[model samples]
Each structure stands twice: as C-alpha cells, then as structure tokens.
Target: DRGAEMEWISQYPHEKEILLPPLVGFQAINTRVERKTLVVELRPSLNLKSPTIEEVIGKLKSSYLTLLDILKGSLQAEALVGPSEERTELHESKAKAAEELGLQRKAHEETNPRWFNNALNYQEASTAAFAIDAKMATKSILAEMKTSGAYTATFGGYQMHKLGLTGL
Candidate 1:
C-alpha cells in the first residue's frame, strides 16, 4: 500500500503537467493515506496569475446537464415500454371477456376502470414527472456546488479506461 501511494505521489507532477497545464501553480496543501484510500489536498497555485475557475464551472454544468438528460431519457423509455405492454395485454383480455359475455363494448373504452385511463396518457405523465423531478434535482445540486468554495468532482474510472487513460 505504501509503495502504491509513493508511486501515485511520484506520478502526480507528471500528471499535473500534462492534465492540468492551466493549474500550473497548484500544490498539495495536505495529504493523507488510509488503508485503501489516498487523499491529496490541493489549492490554486499561488504563483499563477489566474486559475481556470470558469473552465471548471463550465465543465461541471455541462456534466450535470448531460447526466440529467440521460436520466430523463431512460425514465421516459422505461415508462413507454413497461406499463404500455401490460396495458395492451389487459385491453385484449377485456375485449375477449366482453365478447364471451355477449355484452356490447365501446371501441376505445378501457376494460378495467381501476387500471390507467389510457396507457399513452399514463406513460406521458410518468415520463414528464420524472424528467421534471430530475431537472429540479440537478439544478439544486449545481447550485450547491456553485455556492460551495470547495468543490469535489469525481470521474468515472470505466470511462477513463475506455479512453485509454488507465495507464496514466
């Protein structure tokens, strides 16, 4: 573990030089290593004229928006597929039951009054509600991050690996 930590620390200068050119003055203000965790505290380089705070802010905002969009799209797609399939099956069963009973049935009326009034309407409402909630949550998180002077960002390791940055 100590060896790994030493290696990581040793590589920091190179990583900073290549990945954080704009943050040329950044320094490790503090560091701590637990059993499996290594935390290196950093602050803006004192020697730098200006830090790229705007770039960091822009990246954060873009990431939040992209995540929200993906979440909303996934929710909408699930709503469209899940409940609609069940509704179709129920509707068909109702039509068959009505025919067996020799009862007149409306062309577009629902078989079960307790079920959703309409599958399309339910799906649309569910999708819209989830999208709105996700948007609100994203807004709240971004606002909090903006207000907080200390911002912590996490990157997906899998994504980095895919991009061939794992060796870095």
Candidate 2:
C-alpha cells in the first residue's frame, strides 16, 4: 500500500503519527468561512474535504443562528474602539452583518429552539479554524482587517457563508 513508504521513510513513526492529527485538525479549523478570507493561498495546501450540499446546508443554518444570537446581543450599535471596545464592536459588527446577509433577524427569534442551539455549537466549532498552530501567529491581526487574503480563493466565500459571515 502507499503507506508502506510511510513507515520505511522514518524510524520515528511516532513523531509522524503525532504530527498527523494536529495538522489535519488545524486544517479543519482554518478552512472555515470567517478565517478563509484571511488565509487564501494557505487554503489549498491544507487539502481538506469540501463540504457537500447537505453539509453546507447544515453549516449555513447553524451559522445563521449563531449570527442571530450575536446580533441580539449587540442591538445598541455603540462605537467599539481600542482593546476594551473591541469585543463590543465585534459583536455589533457580527450582528449587523447577519442582518445584511439575509438572516431574517425577526423570524430567527421565533424558529425552533433546538435547531438554533445546535447551530450555536457548530459555529463555535467552526470558529476554531483560526486557532490552529498554522494560524496562531497571524490570526488576530490578519482576520480583523476583513481581508486576510483568505477569500482570494473561489471556495472562500462559500465557506464563509457556511460559517454565517455576511458583509466581509
């Protein structure tokens, strides 16, 4: 099998094994919607599986709900500046984006609670893509610009939609 060279090439198969999951895991995390726009060229090198139609729909629904919740939290529309103000601004930005993205803010509130909750969990998981070691050095600053070069690729916008991003 193709794997025969895998062991033969290295005495430290353990090292290879250990490195394997983290790399795959990180790629899984980095290849989502929000992070995609910031990590363009690096995207294809990750060799991740593209989400299928059903998977895409599921991702979209959950992301839509998460955006709804964040929007609900930031209706005040206050100006968020500096580190202390960043969190509030980010929340407001996310909420505003959801509105612009066709999330149907009013109707989202009346939707099934169970489905909504599930979407929140999915959003959290997808957000981890930015946390991978490959991204640790540049995620915060790069992602903030709404132009980390992540979306230069065709799949970027689609992935972002899956993650519930709208106005980026």
Candidate 3:
C-alpha cells in the first residue's frame, strides 16, 4: 500500500498553485438554490476508496489555513504602503469576511443541520476557515469535487466528521 501510494504521488508535481475563488461580492453569500459545482476525475488504475471522514475534515481544515495564509500574505504585502491604514483595512476585511461566512453557515445549517453542525465541530472554527466553505467544498456530507489533483469522497457520518477537526 505504501509503495502504491508513493508511486502514485511521485507521478505528480511536488508543488501546485491554488487559486481561491473570490467571495462573490454580495449576491454570492446567499443562494436560493444550493447548487455547487463538483468536478470528479476517476483514476481507474488507482481505484481509490472514498476518503474517510478524517481525511475529508483534514483537507478542509488545511484549506482554511491556506485561505488565512493568503489573506495574511496579501495584507502583509499591502502593509508596506501604510501600517495604520493597513491595520484598519485588515480589520474591516476580516469583519466583512466573517459576516458573510456567518450568513452562509446559517443557510447551510437550515438544510443539513446534522452535517453542517457536525463537520464544523459545532463551532465556526471562528478562529479560522470562514467555516462553511471547507465542509461544503469537500462534500464532507454531500457530493462531488474532483480532479487528478483533487480528492473523491463519500457522504460522511455525523460522529466521524468531528474526529479530525476539533480543537484545532
């Protein structure tokens, strides 16, 4: 198994560039139809099993860290202009982002209270990932998003979804 996994990973590039989709101005936060685009790529040769709950939550959590990294990185780059203004802008930006994320969390909770509440470990990770995006993006309790570089997953359980995402 280790050999197979290594062989699989070795075939890919060591580094990748990820571009986060913009948090669509205002119209983006609320969707009348909770439709999402999930791209799935099957590797017949690999025949991988559905990602476990831990893997799903882990990947989702990493993505939050990635977003924060991007946010901090850009804010730092902008700070060179004026430290005070940058601080104000950073505070406002974070507040706006948090507000939109909270709205999104409420929407998802209405539809799938168990999954949304469970995967987010019952709290917004408020210290982290905007909250809703990770579980939704990962389809931790839903369906489909894949690429040769991305992962495929099955619907996860209420209990297991909490395993790898809490206290972090």
- The TM-scores, one per candidate, come to 0.22, 0.21, 0.25
lDDT of 3 by residue, 1-168 (tens): 111234334545664433222221122233243357544432222224655555564564444444555544443343344455445543454445545554543444334333433555434543344333343323322221333435444444543345434412
lDDT of each: 0.43, 0.42, 0.41
Cα distance off (Å), candidate 3, residue 94: 11
Q: For model 2, what is the alpha-carbon lDDT of residue 21?
A: 23
Model 2 lDDT per residue over 140-163, tens place: 233554455655323243343444
Give per-residue CA lDDT, model 1, range 1-168, as digits (tens).
011223345655554232334545656889999888999987654345653675443443333334444554443443344455464433343334334222211221323332334557445434543444444344344444556945543335334223432333
User: Which structure is stronger by lDDT: 1 or 2?
Assistant: 1
What candidate 2 gets wrong by more than 4 Å, as runs, is 1-67, 71-79, 82-95, 98-103, 112-155, 159-168
TM-score of 2: 0.21
Task: Write the candidate numbers in order of decreasing lDDT.
Answer: 1, 2, 3
The best candidate by TM-score is 3
